[model samples]
Target chain A: MTSTETTPFREAPIQPGDLLLSIENLHACVEENEILRGVSLQIRAGEIHALMGRNGSGKSTLSKVVAGHPAYTVTAGSIHYRGQDLLGLAPEDRARSGVFLGFQYPVEIPGVSNLEFLRVSCNARRQHRGQEELDTFAFEDHVRETMAIVQMDPAFLERSVNEGFSGGEKKRNEVLQMALLEPLVAILDETDSGLDIDALRIVANGVKKLALPTTATLLITHYQRLLDAITPDFVHVMAAGRILRTGDKDLAMALEQRGYDWIEEADGSDTLQP
Target chain B: MSNVTQSRPRLWLETLLQVLAQWSGGGAAGQPAGARDWGLPTRRSEAWRFTDLRCLTQLDPTRLHTGTAAPHWPEAFRQAPSGQVSPRRLSLQLDGRGHWLSPQGEPPPWPHGLMPLPTGDIAPGQVLRTVIPSGTLLPLGAQLNGVTPGPSLGLQVSGPDPVHLDLAIQAEHAQAWLAPHVLLVLQPGARLCLNWHVAATAQAAVLPMVEARLGLGAQLEEATMAWGCPGAAFLGGSFIHQSPRSVYRRTNATWGWGLSRDEPFVRQSQGQAETHLHGLAVARGQSLLDTHSTVYFDGPAGRLRQRHQALADDRGHSVFNGRVVVPRVAQQTDASQLSRNLLLSTKARIDTKPQLEIVADDVQCTHGATVSCLQADELFYLQSRGIGRDQASRLLQRGFCEEILQRLPQSALLWPSLQSLLETPVPDQP
Candidate 1:
């Protein structure tokens, strides 16, 4: 097959107010156990959504199911990306079509140069956008410029990919990837989990900078500190593998003031529904 | 019945002994007398238990003799434009036989500071006797080499400038068994970086025995690529003795042989020296690759560091036995040995044993071995970045081997085998 025929490139740039992603009744499972059960969400271009839930509430599973993680099987669901069937594509195809998943725990790949990985990944995305692939010299300059967004040190470029990086550094690297890939739908899964206050601010600012009018962001977090920084347009409260409540930024503040138990107590009917 | 069966040499071993006995007649004048009878060790021996030598019996005894010079250079070495030599390095070719072939398929003049040692210095059983006492059994590979001693290249490396030398040992024909020997003596304060490439095709076998002695404050760096074709075998090793204040570093990678075994021995004669040994083994198909290395610290204040890695696929087997001995007299010794292996197929096997014997109360020693498959998370992380699964696997495999390959000399990049070794296709499951 020809390159263009197999590659799932973006036909047109996303515009503000466009429905970039639509996950309807997404029922997914890791092996035999279902994690995301009948969960529904929509992400529009130019908007930010925060998925807040207690542990085991299937927030990360929904993100992974949308990003096409191999371990998760979409048992019964349909995901449409840019109005195209996203479930039939491979993980790489999903990634090339402008879907990015910032992993909670970024894997450490020893002996693989971090710069080379970034360059290859960047070129793959550039090719998807019908842009010229950058050579070694050009990519070095380009990556060096992008590294500034996360305040990344040039020395990290020379080491193995996240081999010895601290938790904060790994999160920054995830953000750096996000800045390079220029995804239309970015799923930042717990990007603020292990970060210090300073790192959290840097990561949040990087995400905020990348959240263009033509792109959308889905911030998956447990606390309201990250929401305070990014100011999500919609806040989601998940319980028993479904979104029980989704309101504007005020919902996150109320949850922060009163812990997650308040959400269960306030919406006991929805929380108790199997 | 079992005792008798174990005592009896196999048919191939008997044939090899007879062939070596015949070839030993026309070899160097002062060849060792009893070496002709030194047969290879059987599987009954503890060291040879994991090694299977049934592949040797398939060779024709008549074709085992060496010294048939290739009509032309191997295709891989012919790429260099004729008559133009790189100033940064020097290259020499050994034609499976004992003779060194110049780049143009003729005998070449020795470069400065890298001349052959005088014939008077060669003892009858020098390599064998140095590592093992008389009447003591040598390892199978070393034993095969010691039996049929042939023309040897013994050089004394001495000069102010560091020497960068490339040696290509190529065996081109079928059933051609090469038993080439090399001896190197580095003078005090001298430095030498030698890269050796050993290639044999068809059913050919190469038994290379290299011995080196490092003087005080001297440094020697050796990088070797022992790449063989299927139906071929490599049974070779190096024996090194290091003096005080000296440094020796070796990185050896072997792959593609039906059976390849290396038993290199290093002795810190007076201690206070530094040793770094890094090795990588790539085993696929039905190949078997093994490395048994021993490092001894004889005096006080010595240091040693070693890392060995192997990748096995198909029905291939990879074995590593690293031994570090620090006795009572060798006080203040510091040493570490780590073996990492990646097994890719259900049938593939990897056996690693890091034996550290330290009796010195004040010394520090550490050793570890880990066998694993590719990390699913690492692969998934790459795939999530738009890289295909196959490409991601290749990247991870390259990363696994690069730790040792990057430590090789810069000149090693010129060899085409190094590229092919890295680009080896990932194995498919049955």
Candidate 2:
């Protein structure tokens, strides 16, 4: 209703492949306004994809819709994870089945201890994976070992979850959860947005260490600085709720050098008026 | 409408008056109980407006049990797993008639720094009466206590060492209506930590009034956990008088009562004292819980911090009215009151009023109230972590209660009833 783009666009037909996640001709909305008009993407195991877009480019909406955020309504879309219809599952079921969305702005839950939340979350995923649940003592040992990956202080475990955390500290906590839950498809939505130089390096390194051949990572960000630390196999430029171009990491560097307006100029339209 | 239908409260009041008269010879020497201004609180009373007393009035008054019965201490109080006594804590129980007994059913001797008040000192109810204004009507619980010939306890806490006392008050029989009064006097430089864990049977009433006076350089930390059954009501009152340089901290967690009301009033008599009041109510089912708290800074340089929280689910209702008064003489007084409430269902209700009446120019007073459902984002955050929606909601509710529950006494923190408060149906369990 606000912009020019209203029709759905399918880039190509899905071919038979061992893809971990496949999103074909996705259209989603929040409230009554459509955010993702028609977007298609594909990710295979062991690949790290970087989704580059400017503000209001539907990057975050894509991540939330993939994770089954209740607020976003998928009007027309088909999402398949491991050949299973992903949209049919609840958010928790998706999470338990190894889909993780690292929120851009992690919610702060007051009075919920960070350690307890982490253990419960980890246990939920473990149970789904046919693993025994860790009791409080065992979980502490496992979590302490995992905390070293994010360089998080043990004091944070005693505090309310993200209640008074600084921006960098909160991002680190998101990565900590990623390590604990061990999701197959980790959507890091702007996980490096508010980090400093040192924190960005630490977080990028953590993500790099966690990326295994059996898992896939979708790094949603605007800048190429994060890619500099953890090289993405492919970088896709998203505009007008659709992927405008897909290329290697060089595209991210080019966009970083020229800014996002360069992508609009190449596309020959000012369609990113969100 | 049938005559009995419209006269249920009237009949209950009439029977209550007769019972009080029979218990107290007559009211005030030949004055009839009905003429002595004894009646159940009506909606006309602002303090009782949001609280429905139907849970109390609907009970059959002819079977109201007033006799003392030995308390059956919950499993938590049974000798600990180690079967060892805690040297730092002295445990006691109050029977239906208010007699102090050990966990094994015998009266225990007062500890070193604690002793029973002399027989000639001020009576148990005298201190509470003085705490009220001259013309103000006494609370219904205090008035009933005045006319009922129940046992009372008065303790004088002194000496340098701190005293830790755990008291359990239980109405173990159905239809038992208990009216017990306690007076605590802390001398200068004295310290006491008192924990009260209370439970009541079905169709019963547990009305307890506690009056305390803290001298200069003294400290009193009091915590209470009250769990009530269906058709039961808990009307508790606490009046504390603190002298300068004294500190008084009171934390209370009450739930499961069909109708529960707590009125705690504190007066920093000469100010320069510190008072901390914390309360939590987990109201579910058709239960109603209300807390009316007031702290008065009568002189200069007083400090007060109070927080009250409630969780209402099903059709339960929770009400809180907190008032902090800083008069002109109480300059430089610093006080803050916060009332936080949660409504878990569409039919559940919560009413909170944090009132600060500051007449002093240089004083700093802040008050706030919030009533809301659990945060949607918080629940989603938990759910996205693979916790089920129901488990996530329960976790958030438990998190909400942990803030106040952690402040309870050690014994109360371990009580199974308090632990299961969020899990079980309130009307069915204590």
TM-score of chain A of each: 0.94, 0.90
DockQ of 2: 0.34
Give interface RMSD for all predictions: 6.1, 9.4
Fnat for each predicted structure, in order: 0.59, 0.53
**Candidate 2 per-residue C-alpha lDDT over B32-95 given as tens digits, one digit per residue, 9 for 90 to 100:** 5344455677887888889788887776766776655544555656773221135445677765
**Complex DockQ per candidate:** 0.44, 0.34
Model 1 misplaced stretches (Cα beyond 4 Å): A1-5, A8-10, A31-34, A127-138, A196-198, A223-225, A268-274, B1-11, B24-31, B65-89, B105-113, B122-128, B133-135, B424-430
Give the range where candidate 1 chain B is weakest over 10 consecutive residues by summed lDDT.
B80-89
How displaced is residue A119 in candidate 2, in Å? 1.9
The model with the greatest lDDT is 2
True contacts kept of 1: 0.59
- Who wins the DockQ comparison? 1
Error of 2 at B100 (Å): 0.6
